[model samples]
Target: MKQLRANREKGMTLVELLAALVLVSLVVILINSVFLFTEKNADSLSKETDVQQNLLLGMKVLTKDVRSTDGEQVTVEKNRLLLGSDEYAAKNGQLLKNGQPVAGDIQSFEVCRPPKGAVYREDELACKPLIAGEADENRIIVILEGTANRAGKSRRLSAMINMER
Candidate 1:
């Protein structure tokens, strides 16, 4: 009995080797799953960020044009807003300025003059932009929406632009 015990202590049995292998295999599987999950989340976040960037780019250009133009020269149409010599139009998933692309991946662009006693809110905008006639010489509302990507993210930016006389 003493001799058998001494021999057993010198080397691991087949059962022990199998148990160790099983433990190592389980740990590897857990690590792989975590890595895969993080990669997927990162990819999703990148796409969402791209959508927001497109919206911001379009918004910045619109605000600049509106602020610089004389209100009389501004014209609002369906998916089109013109400020003096600068033209902004939403067509084919892009925002065009002077017949050149200014922002891509744009889903929609809306511009309108606020009504008398109109209240602006982050969640909703209530105004109908006139296609013809003199625009309000003071302010106009602009809204931009981005195209949905693989992340299925949607973003919107709205602003009440005050024209510089």
Candidate 2:
């Protein structure tokens, strides 16, 4: 009886093996779920970041264009700007430069000549009409707003661009 008991104790029983397998499967399932959740979040965040960077780049290009053009060659309207022969606008959810897409996922683009000597404050562009005696300013206020489709995120950029020429 002692010899038989020693042989049986040399290995796990069928029930114990099955239980171990079940435990391992449960652990694998839990880890897989966590990995999938993390992947989804990472994708969403990446999309949001892409949208933000695109907006920033678009703003930089617009600023460069405005600064390079002469003040007399600049035209500001409610939703469009013309810097000499170059035209910038937001249309059909895109930021367009001379009818070509500059950036995608844009919601709105607004251009205005703020009152003379007006300054930008927190959320206050103050794009009001100029007073009769006020001199025309050599700058423009541009606002760009956009949304990321899959990420459900939005961003806005406001700039005061000065025409140097």
RMSD of each: 3.0, 2.9
Query: What are the per-residue Cα lDDT tens digits for candidate 2 across 69-165?
Result: 7789888888899889999998888889999998876888888877776667737764566655574558788888878557465788887777655
Estimate the TM-score for candidate 2.
0.81
Candidate 1 lDDT trough over 10 residues, lowest sum: 126-135
TM-score of each: 0.79, 0.81
State residue 126's C-alpha deviation in candidate 1, in Å.
Answer: 4.1
- Candidate of highest TM-score: 2
Please give the distance, in angstroms, between residue 137's alpha carbon in candidate 2 and its true position after superposition: 3.7
**lDDT tens readout by residue for model 1, 72-124:** 89987656788887889888988899889988888888877776456668677
Question: Clash totals for all models, in order?
Answer: 0, 0
For candidate 1, list the clashing residue pairs, or say none: none
Error of 2 at 60 (Å): 1.3
lDDT of 1 at 42: 94
